[model samples]
Target: MKGLFLDAVDELAAVFRHVARPGDPPMDVIERGEIRPEELPGLIAGYDFILDDHTALPTEAMRACAGLKHVIFLGTGARSYMNPEELADLGITVHTIKGYGDTAVAEHTIALMWAAARGLACMDAGMREGMWLRTEGVELTGKTIGLLGFGGIAAEVARIASGSGMRVLAWNRSPKAAPGVTFVDLDTLLAESHVLSVHLLLNDETRGFLSAERLAKLRPGAILVNTARAALVDKTAMLDALRSGHLRHAALDVFLTEPLPAGHVLTTLPNVTLSAHSAFRTPEASEKLLRMALDIACGL
Candidate 1:
């Protein structure tokens, strides 16, 4: 079977080569800077499988690629790129990798939280510009952290927060328990937590899960952190709350629109810290991601 690695960004390609085995189907890497939906059909013309990192394979494009049978998405949030159900209807099996970068992402979440709480990024930027800005930050000790979803990433966050002397409370779609963590209802988690971290997967039910009404339930001046898909939170609502000072700050690694268009409102806010959706990035996580993708591709 012929396979194409569409949008194989650098560094990751090196890791992919290391894990790819001999005797496997020939794989081609297209080193383009970006792939848009309109370019999908021509780019994937006759490949039996495509390994996509962040490119979109819209249903219309998938229908045009007559030979494409499998999509080995490099991460778990394949829905953000292509709808699995829609592709499945076209006889294309969408495979996603999970548990490959849980610890890496969790560590990043903690890093963002600390950065937001301490104004680390702003301070660093100011210092680089010859200005020394020291902003007072809230202490995390004895504070309550709310986990929006209790999955692998959230579990890891719970572990780290607990070790740091912060009380952890989580609200999953279903019940879950972990040492030194309490499982609470959504309202309780919102009303009580001083810091709220979102880790839910994006789906119909979870899309816009943190709406304006729900966000208002959070304690005034609460900190918000999301390493999950940005669509989970209503962007307008979040901006309003931040502008009103209802939310103390936000540490965001993902945005509804990636590469977040220049001059986006979120960029202008002082209380918001932005990361380029790189929370899951690390040497260790990169290796695991490549190995897992290759395993899935080879299995097919």
Candidate 2:
């Protein structure tokens, strides 16, 4: 089937070419920056399927594309950009790739956890501004880290944290087991964990899962690391927790808005560490992701 790689930035375009095989389905890559939802119909006119990377595909806009049958989202968080159920009603199937960047994202989760625990970003910014900032750092060796969801990414995170001598606790919606990890109920996980890392998928059931009441259950002074979706936690509640120092710190990779606006409240917070949702941008992960996307297209 003819396909288009919609919204492939230059870096992604390069990776796509690197992983393309000779016998693969015909696919064209559109090397451009972000496109508006209104531009969707024109760009995907004759494509049977499209490989989407961080683009918004409104059902209304997609309705105009008559021949499109499938959308192979480059990552698992397709719900952040489009309503899969709505698209399905339009006769379009949405496919998501998993485990492509598990290691990359897991390593990033650990890095953010450490950075927040140690106040690294605050000190770094202070140093850049001609001040010698020496902040007390948390020693993670004996800390307890709770994984909110047990998935491939969280499994890798549990392994790393366990190797570092940290106690690992996980709570998943369904039953799951992993070595060196203790499976606990949500309340126990919240009350005992010194560090809490969110790894849940964003969906109707899980959106704003960490509400004000739930955030209140966290151990006072606990650090939070989220490489998962932003909507998973209540934004106002998180801000209140951070501002009130109920939460020791928060390290975030995703946000309610992309390109988090200049002078945003989050940017102004000293207890917060922010990354541009780049936990899965490593070269190894990029190569694996594109290769897997191509593999999925072959199956389609």
Candidate 3:
């Protein structure tokens, strides 16, 4: 089968080579800095499968690609890139890999939580400019951290937080159990947590789940961390809370808009720490993602 890797930026060529065996499939890379919907068709015309990292495959483009039957997305956020049901109607099955970067993302989430609580980013910037700044950071020990969803990444977060002597609490749409973790109702979790981390998937039911009213229910001076999709939270409400000091700080790895645009309001906020949606970006996760993609393609 013929495969095309669209938007293969960040030195992923070696990963594809490592995962793909000779004679299994012929793959080509189009290393464009950015991909628009208009350029997708010509770039992936004759390929039977397309591997997309962040390119959006709209319904119109998928319908135009007659030879395309499969799309192997790099991560589980395919819905953010393309509508899976719409692509399936056009004979393209979108495949996503989960749990490949669970530990990688969980570790990054913990790092961001620590950074936000301690004002590490701002202090580091001041020190680099030859100014000594000492900021008092909140203690994590004996504090309550609430997980919004209990998935693989959340489980890993719970493990780490519990090990650090922080109390772990979680709320899920369905029931779940982990040793020493408390499962509470949504309202209870919101009012009681010192740190709240979002781990829910983005879908029709969960988009904007953290609305303005819900944001108001959070404990005063609470720290919020989101390593999940940005759509899960109301962007305007979150910004307002951060600016009003209702929320002490936010460590965000995802945004409503990817690349976040230059000079966005979130960029100017002193209380917000932003990552370029790179929580899942580790060498080990990259290898696992490539291997899983190759396995899916080979199975097909």
CA lDDT, candidate 2, residue 184: 99
**156-176: candidate 3 lDDT, tens digit per residue:** 999999999999999999999
- Superposed Cα deviation of residue 247, candidate 3 (Å): 0.4
Summarize candidate 1's per-residue lDDT along 1-300 as a digit string, tens digits.
Answer: 899999878577878787788967789998775888788888898899988888878898778888899999999999998889999999999999999999999999999999999998888888999998998998999999999999999999999999999999999998788888899999999999999999999999999999999999999999999999999999899999999999999999998888899999988898999999999999899899888887777778
Superposed on all Cα atoms, model 2 deviates from the true structure by an RMSD in Å of 0.8
Worst 10 residues of 2 by lDDT: 28-37
Give the alpha-carbon lDDT of every model: 0.91, 0.95, 0.91
Superposition TM-score, candidate 2 onto the true structure: 0.99
What stretches of model 1 exceed 4 Å from their correct place?
none
Off by over 4 Å in 2: none
RMSD of each: 1.1, 0.8, 1.2
Candidate 3: which pairs clash?
A: none
Misplaced by over 4 Å in model 3 are none
TM per candidate: 0.97, 0.99, 0.97
Clashes of 3: 0
